[model samples]
Target: MTPDEYAAALDAERSARNDRARYVVCEEHGAHALMRRNGSGQAWGVARHVSQETAELAAAFLNRLKEDEA
Candidate 1:
């Protein structure tokens, strides 16, 4: 997905949880963001550069390794 589309989705998700939350799209990383809150609340965002295919593959391999260790 394009950076703008991903950023929009992120913003929507954050805003849904808290309207006061602040979100800014990271220009250097298309899939990342800088998020914060005004008060003593949690500061959080996402790093989403990895493709779904890679994530799935990594999860599968990690599960297999865990099984072997057990």
Candidate 2:
């Protein structure tokens, strides 16, 4: 995914959930958004620095992060 794709996913997730507390974009890990609930936390991965090759993978990892929070 490119930067545009990452941005779109972020928008979608934000619209769907209202529990997110922060968004972190890491050079090493790409775009990561954090969600907190009941004092607990979760993270969702976006694209890897706007790169298409790693975007989907990062997104998948992020989805797992959300599940872990659950």
Looking at model 2, residue 22 earns an lDDT score of: 35
lDDT of 2 at 15: 52
lDDT of 1 by residue, 5-48 (tens): 99999877655545444333333353343334333566654333
RMSD of each: 16.3, 13.6
Lowest lDDT 10-residue stretch of candidate 1: 22-31
Reference-based TM-score, model 2: 0.29
Residue range 4-38, candidate 2, lDDT tens digits: 99999987776555344333444454443332233
lDDT of model number 2: 0.50
Off by over 4 Å in 1: 1-49
Top model number, TM-score: 1
